[model samples]
Target chain A: MTKLIVEVQDLWKSFYIRHNRNDSLKERFISLFDGRRRERREVFWALKGVNLEVAQGEMVGIIGPNGSGKSTLLRVIAGILRPTKGSVTVRGSVAPLIEIGVGFHPELTGQENIYLNASLYGLTRKEIDRIYDEVVEFSGLEDFIDVPVKNYSTGMYMRLGFAIAIQLDMDILLVDEVLAVGDEAFQRKCLAKMQEFKERGKTILFVSHALELVSELCDRAYLLVNGQVILEGVAREVVACYHRGQIPIRHE
Target chain B: MGSWMRGLTRIIRYRELVRNLVAKDLKVKYRGSVLGLLWSLLNPLAMIVVYSLAFQYILRIPLENYPLFLITGIIPWNFFSGAVIASSEAIIGNANLLKKVKFPLEILPFATILFNFVQLLFALLVFFPAVFWFKTGVTPLILLYLPVLALQFLFTLGVAFFLSSITPRYRDVRHLTEVALMVLFWLTPIIYSISMVPGKLQPLIKANPLTAFITVYQDIIYWGRLPSTEMLISMVLWTGLSLGVGYSLFRRRQRVFVEEL
Candidate 1:
């Protein structure tokens, strides 16, 4: 049996909505002492009692329609967001490619952002320095490395983000449709890297609407409808099942 | 690990981020501005020029080295206020960073103080050139005030961290701080001489930490004298008390800060 690497149980998250929708000083004052029911915070449940278990070295895909709990579930598993009720425990380092350039500063050069991003992912300065050349070569922006990331194109931004994330040496990779960015050539390169990672027994939990790509990469898949998982099992089977149900993935 | 202790360690581990953030603050603030760092020097100079006109030219206080006195007090006061305003929004301004990333949140406040510290250091460099041009004699006792200035730095940092933590939840703390500082600035002799105030106000003025802190600065830089023993002891006590309280407040709120964001 494969060793268990991730376990999530009864995860539930609810966000309060302000009754006054219009955020203003006068409205704020009126709502201050009013009854909470009268003030109207309609609850938005991002995730509802999600439970799942994944073992080491498994490549899993989460397929969901718009407003499905896929991203929220992944965020909770990555420890970025707290579940309203439930717990998730994971073994080893988790590298999340949620948004590659999430923390990149515009004024700082690419070299500086590499240091910033790698460190944000918990790599020491010495480790980043060691992989510095490899990351640069991967991005294919050697000449423009000195230039600020603000000058980078969408493809260049995606390339650099992918390079840094791929170098994390993490036990588990949480990918969220980041591979959809670059050209067909770069997309193949990313898939090739994933295949290489699979050879090393690294676990991957990916979220993508590309059914063909998901089946090509993930051995198992889960389909989420609204906030609940409606289907699970072989990727091809689940994708077929979800599409037949008329579910649409939210396009970012 | 407890979130507070974890935050402290994370800051030490990510010291470079602190440096980068401070650099970012200084760079962005001065960028696209015609005056550049001239703003730092202009602040104290403008206040000194106005005070000289109001006091010597109009009120005729006949105070010795009055402009010099004003500059010394104004320099530290500016640093104190700069750290205050910078830190009040440190958490709020970086809400995007705080929401998605796991970092030692205290660095946010620490970086705010460090940012102003760099600006204050530039102002200090300007002071030295002016002092030599005016032929002001350098004294060993003046150098002795280095420890006192350190105490002031600690005191300011403590308040900034404490306020940064509190302001995220109770935003009124910002407006409250502005009004409180306005009252506190008057209590400080930034524009006028403490000697001119009535004897009854003397003890109260001395009790005011900023007043005491600035008075010590004015003595060493302007008059080339040592601060009185009472002032040194009181300053030390206040610094320690403020630091302890500030750390406690930051420690309490750090866990909920992620949720708050």
Candidate 2:
């Protein structure tokens, strides 16, 4: 049996919403003296008691509607957002393709941005140098590499962003609705790359709204609504359930 | 202590990210300007001209070589103020990156401080020659400048971490920091000598953490003497306290920064 590379148990996250009419010093000072006029705040739970497990080399997909905590789940697993209660354990390094070009600076040239973007993903300078040529060649922007990224066409920009992420050979990859922004050819390339990672026995958890892509790429899929996993099973079966509208719209 | 060590190791491991971020900041700052990197030198030169004319000719201060006195204090003060001001928005300004990426949040403030630190070094190189021209002359005590500077950097880093972490919650912090820095500039003895103030008020002025730092800069750069033991002790105390307070506050608030943003 393949070992579990990712395990999340009883995960919970909440945010506090402050309700104050005035933030000015004078009002705050007055309110401090008048104990009756205190600022009010409300608590909001974005995710509640979420549990998930993915074995090594497994390809899993997460699907949900807007405000369904799909991205939140991915963010928690990627270690970007802390879970308020419960635990998340991952055995190896993770490469998060949640948002391409997250740290890319517009003023820097393509070559310069590649290094900065790669480093943001926890790649060492030496590691980036080792794969510099491959990343550049793969992006197919060799002639425009020296030009500032701000000047690149949107398609060229997306190509470079995807290329930098796919080059890093991390143990667990977390992808979040990123492939939807690229062209058909780029999407095809991304799908093929995911397939290659699967063949290499790397674990991947993808979040997407595209049901067909989830059905095609994921071995097993999870359906989340209102911050809880409503269904989990074989990818095709879960996709079918979602299409059949079994999960109703949740009222806040 | 174990957590602190882990934090240190994490930061050390990402030193290259720090270097690259600092480099990127410097590059972006001067990218579109006509003067480009020359502004780093020209900015202090302009301040010397403006402040000397205002303080010496207009106010008729008796201190000789007033420009040298001002340069030593002004350069270090600029570093502190620049870093602190940038700290106010370091986290908020990078909200998108913070939401998407999972690196240390302290890296933002660290990069902002180091950016100003690099500019401070350039300004110092320009000021060093003025030291000779003003006949302050170098002393063996000047070797102590580096250790003192490292201390100030730590203090600034700690303050940066604290302010950046809190600013997201208190949007007013950005404006508050600007006013606070302006107040702090005059509070320290940057424009006038501490002796110029009444002897009774000297201790009060010295109470400011930057008092010791500014005085030390003057001792090594202008007076050619070693900083007093009292001044050195105060510097170390402030540095340690700020780091302790800043790091703890930062660690506490960092987990919730994403939600707040």
Candidate 3:
């Protein structure tokens, strides 16, 4: 059997929504003396008992409605969020394109942000140097490379973010709604790059609301609802099930 | 022990991130200004002139070449205060990066301290000529400067880690750090000598962690003599204590940083 590259077992994650937000020391101190001033919080479980596994070279899609914990799952697999319970074991390095342009400083030029953004992904200076030309070329921002990224339009920003992420050579790619902003041609290019990654035997965990794209591109998919996987099987079947709107939407 | 080793290796691997961050800060700070790096020196020069008028001419501080003493103490103290105050913003300011990326969070505060450190070095370069001009005359003992500076760097880094870690949860830490630094400036012997402090308060002044570092700078640069054993011991102990407490706290609190942010 092919080796499993990503294994997440019985995962759980929670966040606290604070009311009155006593973030300052003064409020915290005052809340101590006055009973009505006490800050209130409610536990928000973003992911509950999520279990998943992906073998090397498999393209897996995660389809879920808004607030169904899809992004939270990606964040946990990327190691940006800690699971409140359970374990996530990945055998290789992961390049998370979750909300790209993460480390880009607005004051820095496009060329500078490439270095800064790539380094945030754990790329060394030499590694960035090797790919610098390719990144600018791929993003097609050669003329504006010297200009600060703050001047770039939203499309240009996403292109640069996508360009930098795709250039990094990692074992697993966790892509979350990154193509939502780019134009048709750029989206085609991103899809082509991902297809190339799959051909090169790289594992991919894709999260998107594009049901047609999920059915077409993913080898298998999971439909998550209320923080649990309600359906898992062939991508087309899951997409059809989701299209039928058969899953119940849980209320708070 | 294994986790500590892992953290060290992670830091070594990401040294380039720290360098990039420090470079970014320097570029952002000086990008629009005409004087650029010379601006860093202007602060200390202005302070020296004002303190010379107040402490030397009016208050009549008994020390010879008082500006030289102030230069040695004030510049280092500026570095400590600047780094500590900036640390409060290090983690909170990068909430976007912290939420999206998975690189070492420690690098945020570490880079902040390094940025201030670069400024301290710039200030020192401009003022070293003033030391010779005052005829304080350098001694071979000045060779200890780099080693002592390394200790101070580690010490400030520890405080940076501590402050940056807490500031995310408690927004008031930034204000608290500024007020505390203002009080600390007076407690430290930056403008005045320890000898001028009341004898009963001598031990208390000596006990201030900054006193050891500043007094050592004075001993080597101004007095041209070896630092007393007690001064050396305090420097090491303070550095050790700060790193031990600050880093451990940072490591423990860092887990919930994204949640806090």
Candidate 4:
């Protein structure tokens, strides 16, 4: 049996959106005496209670139609967000490549961002120095490394971001749709790297909409609908169910 | 360290976030500038030239070593106020990063104030030469202002963090900040000497915490005298209280920042 690395018990999250109001302060003041409208109302629950567990070295893919709480669940697992009402127990160091280059400074050079990104990922300067060459070489952008990242093309930016992320040595890696950003070759490279990570026994929680990638990479998968886990089983079976729901099958 | 404390300890625990944020701020600031970070010094110098032109050339406000007085007063005032304005928006501007990355909320405002302090240090390099040009005598008492400055920085940070945390919630607060800053500028004795204010007005200005702090600053740099014991107590107390309250508010609201953002 694989060692368990994460435990989730009935996680729930909701948001209180103070309703939007139009009309200026003056208009509101004028209407106040007549009671035109006082306070706005309502709350949105982005996630109902959600529960799941993934063992160490398991690559689990989470698929859902939009607003099915996939990203929210990923956020809670990464500890970037708090669940409204449940316990999410993560056992090891978790590195979330949630978004490509979320902290990249526009003016800083690629080399500078590498250090900043590495530091943000909990790596010390010395550790970044050790892996600096590997990061740049994998990024395939040695010539542009000195240039400010603002000068980088989308591909260059994604490459640098991916390079920084892939170098992070963490037990649990939460990958969002970052691999979907770059060119075909780069995407293939990212897939290969994820495969390499699998070989190295790093656990991954992959969230994406691509059925083929989900089936190919994830040993176990879940189909989420309306902020609830509607189905869970083998990846291919889940994908088959997901696609079947997408297009109606006529019975003879 | 204490139980009454709520948020500052949390910020201390995430010290890495603060360091990275400070670095990110410093890098992003001059990133687009052609002169790079020289922009910080250029701003104070430009202000000095314009103020000198107005006071010395046009109005002819005749006074001995007047340029020295203005530079000493204006540079710190600029640092303080610039930090206030910048810090008040620190968390709001980094809303995206705050929502995405789970770090201490105080890190954002701390980073803002820290970067401003760095720029203030740069501005000081330009400011010190004028002190000697005016031939002001250096006294041991002048060194006393370092602790005073450390206090003032803390106070500004506290106020900035407090204001920034609330500003995003009630956006009308941002519009009113300019007026508050203007009031603070006049109260702090930036453009004029403390002696110039009437004796009755002096007490009122002294009552303004920032003015009391600035008075300490000008005392050492201009008059070469140490600030009185009462002034020192006031400065330290103000920094402590503002930071205590400001950090608390920031800490309490931090978890909710993503939704607010």
Q: Decide which is better by lDDT, 1 or 4.
A: 1
Q: lDDT order of candidates, best first?
A: 3, 2, 1, 4
Show where candidate 2 strays beyond 4 Å. A19-39, A248-252
lDDT of candidate 2 over A114-229, digit per residue (tens) = 88888777678999999899889878899999898899887788888878887888899899888877789878987898899889999999998999999988999999988888
Q: Going through the candidates in order, what is the number of backbone clashes in each?
A: 0, 0, 0, 0
Please rank every candidate by TM-score, starting with the best. 3, 2, 4, 1
The lDDT per prediction is: 0.80, 0.86, 0.92, 0.78
TM-score of each: 0.86, 0.95, 0.98, 0.90
Off by over 4 Å in 4: A21-39, A246-252, B2-28, B31-34, B49-63
Task: Evaluate model 3 with DockQ and give the value.
Answer: 0.81
Query: Which structure is stronger by DockQ: 2 or 3?
Result: 3
Output the better candidate (1/3) by DockQ.
3
Best by lDDT: 3
Off by over 4 Å in 1: A21-42, A246-252, B1-6, B31-39, B129-136, B166-180, B200-207, B228-230, B256-261
Classified by CAPRI criteria, candidate 3 counts as: high
